[model samples]
Target: MARQTPLNEAHRKLGARMVDFAGWDMPVQYSGIIDEHEAVRTAVGLFDVSHMGEVEFTGPGALETVNALISNDLARIADGQAVYAGLLDERGTFVDDVVAYRFSPERILICVNSSNREKDFAWMKAHAQGVAPVDRSDDYAQIAVQGPKAAGLVQRLTKTDVSKIGTYRFAEGEVAGVPSIISRTGYTGEDGFELYCAAKDAVALWDALLTEGQQDGVKPCGLGARDSLRTEMKYALYGNDIDDQHTALEAGLGWIVKLDKATFIGKEALVAQKAAGVKRKLVGFELTGNGIPRHGYAILKDGARVGEVTSGTKGPSVNKAIGIGYVPAELAAEGSTFDVDIRGRAVPAVVVKTPFYKKP
Candidate 1:
């Protein structure tokens, strides 16, 4: 049986259509993906992300211990700030993508992908130099309230002065009578907060937000919309656009990899690759002809296979069929054209500027 989140009963009661994802029984959709997708783009949407893993490091060396495992430099950001980074192996390839939150030198938290929870913990344990990591996945439940109107809706329930919490920052306060950590972050390309509260309080927190956000047309979203939203923004999804086989440089995530920082996992490999230059790069493209591109579809150059689609979907917000794929660096330029093998037919595609949907 797939594991269930703390909000599993609440999800079913709200008429969510559940699906197994990353070994968890989670909601795939409620009022359909399109409606939920538009709700987030136009108004507000709530997502149960409790299945995501949270690991912590304590002791004065907490920051130093985790900093050596990830590619980003946490020393660059001040307290109350979080950074999106990659957990890389010695080969400079992704172990997983994660968000590291810095509370202080004595404590830090890492939110990891659900599928990589155990693997990430084990990796950190084996690589840890002094401090040890503790798995806190079951200790908390996370709810993401996102959209243009999302902040207002969340602010209504919390007295934490949400406005003062700028993007990528977080604070601890009471929300709807529940003690919570309100992080101004989200996977959807919108301004919002991801509230982390005691697992026992998830249903109440989820209910309070939905009850209060109804006026703003906040809909309960699920993984389908979540996938589409991230794909539309060209945000790489682990196990899809990124994996151990692909280096961070090839995946276009070099900005998060700071070579000047202290020696960390994968630094040597990345430095070497940077000097040598990456051969293949991930690129975004739009289908010029009919048919929606799907993952694993072959990307062809001059009718010969050259690459494969990593993630693709018919974007609901942009109202266009878009996809991301890996291709030779020579073919990654704007206006470069290729063919995507859809089933068996070849469909013409053209590389375009990424972020298929931008705030208007």
Candidate 2:
């Protein structure tokens, strides 16, 4: 049986086409993937992202415990701010990627992908013997408001001044009379806020936002549009872009690693790899012709398989087919050309700068 989010009924009322994703019944599209995608690019679109998992760590050793789990340093993430980092195995393979938010001196929240929730919790628990208590709050519900108009819509509904919150910062407040965590962050390459509220208040918050945003062209968006938007921004998807076999270096997340900070899991291996060299690097590209690159497609250079496509989609906003893939560092430069094996037919592609599309 697939788990349903608290806003499932609201999605149905909006005539969303729902599907099972990683054991959760989620809406894939409402009016259409392209429409919703464009709306988010130009105006604003709301997404039910309650399927994500949240774990809280707070105690005397909570900060110390969290610093040992991921590749990045938590001390750099300021109070009320969030930083993107990866949880790694001993071998430096990515266990999962997460957004760590520092709420206070002793309290912090880690948001992770849903499919790996249990595995992540178990891993943290086993390693957090001396750290603060790790508690799962999967019952909470979340919604993301994304795009240029996202801030405007949020300001109309929330009591706090949206401008007061800096990027990657969050505040505890109310939206439509419902207590919520309004974080100025989003998956798309746009200004937005992600709302976290109690499960029971999920539907009410969703309703209030939709009603308020209706005149501003706010539409109910789904996972399909969300995926495309993130792909356009070159934002990685967990299962697709980063997996257990890839490390932060290979996955293009070296910026988050803080080797100078106190040691953490996979620190030695990362240091070794960084000192020596990395085999491959993640890069962005666009299909040259009419074909659309898909995940798992073989990337060929000089007629030899050199890499694989991780995330690919037809970017509605950019009106092009774009994707992210891993290739040798030598072949990861901009304007580098390669062929993606799409259905056994080689499709020409060229590596371009990341964030294929950024709306101004």
Candidate 3:
């Protein structure tokens, strides 16, 4: 059976079509994928992202524990800030990509993938050894309000001042009488806010936001649009763009790794890999002739297999087919030519800079 989010009823009330996704009954679309996708790029859209996992780190050694566990430096982030980072095994293989929220001097929250909640928590706990209190918080629900007008939409509904919050910053406040954590961040590369609130108040908060933004063209968005929007920005999707088999060094996420900081879980392995140089690297491409590039399609260089597509889609905003894939570092340069084997036919492709589609 698929788990339903607290806002499932609210989605249904708005005529959203629900589908089983990663063990959760999530909305695939409300009006249509393209419409919702464009609405977000132009106006605003709300997404029920309660399926994401939230892990809490507490105790005196919490900072030290995270510094040793993640590839990013947790000590540098100030309170009420967030950082995009990855958890790697001892061998430098990615365990999961996460966003760490520094809520206070002693409290840090790590948001992870829903499917890997148990495994990620267990891994962190086991690695803690005599570190901090790592508690898995599955009680909170999350929602993303995104697009160009997303900030205004959220500001209108909440009494708290959001004007001062900069990007990647968060504040604890109440929205529509529901206690919430409003973060100035989003996956869609838009000006938006992600609200973390109690599960019991999720439904009411969703309804209140929708009602407040009804006049401003705020539509109930779904996973389909969310995926499309993120793809436009070429944001790495965990299971697709990255995985346990791939190292952060090979995935173009080296910026998140703070090797200069204290010793980390995969520090030794990462240090060796960095010294040796990475082999295969993640790159972006655009379909030249036609046909959308789908995941797992073979990437050919000079009629020989080089790599494969990981994430692809025809971006609604750009009106062009774009994708991310792994290929040899030599062939990863921008403008390098390649071919995608789609249905046994070769389709022309070119290595393009990431963020295939950027919001104007």
Candidate 4:
């Protein structure tokens, strides 16, 4: 049996189509994938993301200890700020991609993917020389309100001036009388807020938000829409777009890897790879011909396999078949042409500028 999130029963009550995802029974969709996807694109949508894991660290050495494990520079941001970073193995491959919220010099919270919860906690614990990390995943339930109208909807329930909270910043306040962490963050490539409240308060918070946001057309969303939204933005998925077999640099996440920061777990390997140059690189592409690309599809040049697709879908917002894949660096430029092996037939595709969909 899979584990259930605090909002599991609520999801069932809402008639969500449930499926097993990384040992958790999660909703894949409610109304429909396309309807839910467009709800987020045009108006607002609420998502029960309570399965994501949170690990907290506190004490005098928290900053140093955390900075050493992640590739992003924690020193760059002040309190109430968060940063997207990669937790890497010694070989420079991702253990997981995470968001580190800096509450203070002595306190930090890391939000990790549910699929990698246990692995991430164990990895952090093993390297904890000065500060120990506590798994707090079960203590909270996270709700994401996403889209252009998301802020206005969330603002109805919170006392905090959410309009003043810039991107990647957060504040702690009460929402419908329940204490919560209101963070200006989201997985969808849109303006949104992710609220973290006590697990026990999840139902109340969910009900309150739905009631308040009804006028804004906030619909309940599911994992299917989440995957499509992230893919449209070219955001890498852990087991698919990125894995231990592939380094962050090769996965097009080199921007998050701050090699200049004090020695990190993968610094040496990354330095060596940087010097040697990345052999293959991840690139975004759109199908020029008919056919939707899917994961594991072979990417070919002159009918010979050169790479494979990582994530692909019929982009709901762009209304095009798009995908991300690994190819030799020499062929990663925009407008570069390649062929995708779709069920034994070669379909044409072209590398294009990433973020298949951008909010205007």
Clashing pairs in model 4?
Answer: none
Q: Identify the leading candidate in terms of lDDT.
A: 1
Put down candidate 3 lDDT per residue, 1-360, tens digits, no spaces.
Answer: 889889888888889999999889999999999999988998899999999998888777777777778899878989989999998898887889988998775678899888778789899888874455454555899999998888888888788899988898999999989999999989897899999999999998998888898877998899999999998888989889899888899999999998898688888888899999999999989999789999999999888999999999999988999989999989889999899998889999999887887646
Q: List residue ranges in candidate 1 displaced over 4 A.
A: none
lDDT of 2: 0.89
Error of 4 at 323 (Å): 0.2
Each prediction's RMSD to truth: 0.6, 1.2, 1.2, 0.8
Tens digits of per-residue lDDT for model 1, 1-360: 999999999999999999999999999999999999999999999999999999999998999999999999999999999999999999999999999999997799999999999999999999998899999999989999999999899889988899999999999999999999999999889888899999999999999999999899999999999999999999999999999999999999999999998878999999999999999999999999999999999999988999999999999999999999999999999999999999999999999998888999
- The residue-by-residue lDDT of candidate 4 on 1-360, one tens digit each, is 999999999999999999999999999999999999999999999999999999999999898899999999889999999999999999999999999999998999999999999999999999877899999999989999999999998888888899989999999999888899999999999999999999999999999988898999989999999999999999999999999989989998999999999778999999999999999999999999999999999999999999999999999999999999999998899999999999999999999998999877
Which 10 consecutive positions of candidate 2 have the poorest summed lDDT?
A: 129-138
- List lDDT for all candidates, in order: 0.95, 0.89, 0.88, 0.94
For candidate 4, the 10 contiguous residues with the lowest summed lDDT are: 151-160
Please rank every candidate by lDDT, starting with the best.
Answer: 1, 4, 2, 3
Clashes of each: 0, 0, 0, 0
Candidate 4: global Cα-lDDT? 0.94
**TM-score of model 1 relative to the true fold?**
0.99
Scanning candidate 3 in windows of ten residues, the lowest lDDT window is 129-138
As a TM-score, model 2 comes out at 0.97
